[model samples]
Target: MMKLDICQSEVGTGLPSYSWDWWTENEANQFPQELEPSTWVKLSEVPSSFSFEEALLLCQCSPDSWLAWIPDHGEAVLHRSQFS
Candidate 1:
């Protein structure tokens, strides 16, 4: 399995952002050949140490980072951050 480091922007809930750096070609190359093309790696296909509830909390509370895998996406990471 491929490993990725997830990082969250320091910006708070007003506009929270998370980045999966491993999705890039340069970063993917650091891993096995299988991950050369990130499109082949679905977000849902990977395992994550976090839960839905935890993700929800992270969205609500930005400036937090989690080393988690990308979830399967139809087009792109569609998760949005919204403050209550």
Candidate 2:
């Protein structure tokens, strides 16, 4: 399959209160249910400390690392970074 690059926003110095709950709530508003696994690639072996900032940093700092979607006390979703 043809490859595609993904674009994700960086937390930067803002969003000190960013957390998994915040993400899920916002997503819930947009999507009543989680998108199918095929819609978005989920990463593997996501770290327990996974955060959007951490994933972004990992992609920026360690390009080989996956974009991890780890919510505290929830299942983790990881994805290969095509843009990393």
Candidate 3:
């Protein structure tokens, strides 16, 4: 299994963007997702304490920086040095 590398630039900040390609092109049903939009881990690995994106971070299933995240429709993506 290929581990997704969380993108961290020299500035240590990322512009998390929604990639329908990233979201769709990521997996081929290797793992069951709790949330089809962002989750890539198995359903049992999902943590109730964290958001789905956070779970992706903790699981290291993303290739984008912390700023790069899955966004709900109409939700705005802002520039932030810190997430949450």
Candidate 4:
């Protein structure tokens, strides 16, 4: 299984922006090779301008199980069993 850290952020005004950042190549390389690219679209709500909420939701819907890394808050791992 591949492990990825998901971070969501909102920017701009009016429509509420959203943005997402996947780990660097070096970081992603640490995961298992068999695992496919992780998806990030189920943790939170969608954003009008690609806000952080959209990223969180994407992470939740990721194909490969992922562990979320929240600054100062620790981590959150997604499990198929939980949602299914």
Please list the C-alpha lDDT of all candidates, in the order they appear: 0.31, 0.37, 0.32, 0.40
Candidate 2 — worst ten consecutive residues by lDDT sum? 54-63
Error of 1 at 52 (Å): 8.2
Higher-scoring candidate on TM-score, 2 or 4: 4
Cα lDDT tens digits for candidate 1, 20-81: 45357775456442212222232332233332211111121123222232333112232222
Using TM-score as the measure, the top candidate is 4
What residue runs in model 4 are displaced by over 4 Å at the alpha carbon?
1-16, 19-35, 44-51, 54-65, 69-74, 81-84
Ranking by lDDT: 4, 2, 3, 1
Q: Write the per-residue lDDT of candidate 3 for residues 38-84, one digit (tens) a residue.
A: 43222222123232342232222233322224323122222222232
List candidate 1 stretches off by more than 4 Å.
1-15, 33-84
Residue 10 displacement in candidate 2 (angstroms): 38
Compose the digit string of candidate 4's lDDT tens values, residues 8-75.
64544356334445555676556344333343333342223222342221244355565554322344
In angstroms, the error of model 4 at 29 is 29
- Residue-wise lDDT of candidate 2 within 1-84, one digit each (tens)? 999998786857564665443345555356423223223332333454433333331221232333333334333324343311
C-alpha lDDT of residue 1 in model 4: 100
lDDT of 2: 0.37
* Candidate that scores best on lDDT: 4
Return the clash pairs for model 1, or none: 43-70, 43-71, 43-72, 44-71, 44-72
Cα RMSD of all models vs. native, in order, equals 18.7, 16.6, 17.3, 16.3
Candidate 4, run of 10 with poorest lDDT: 49-58
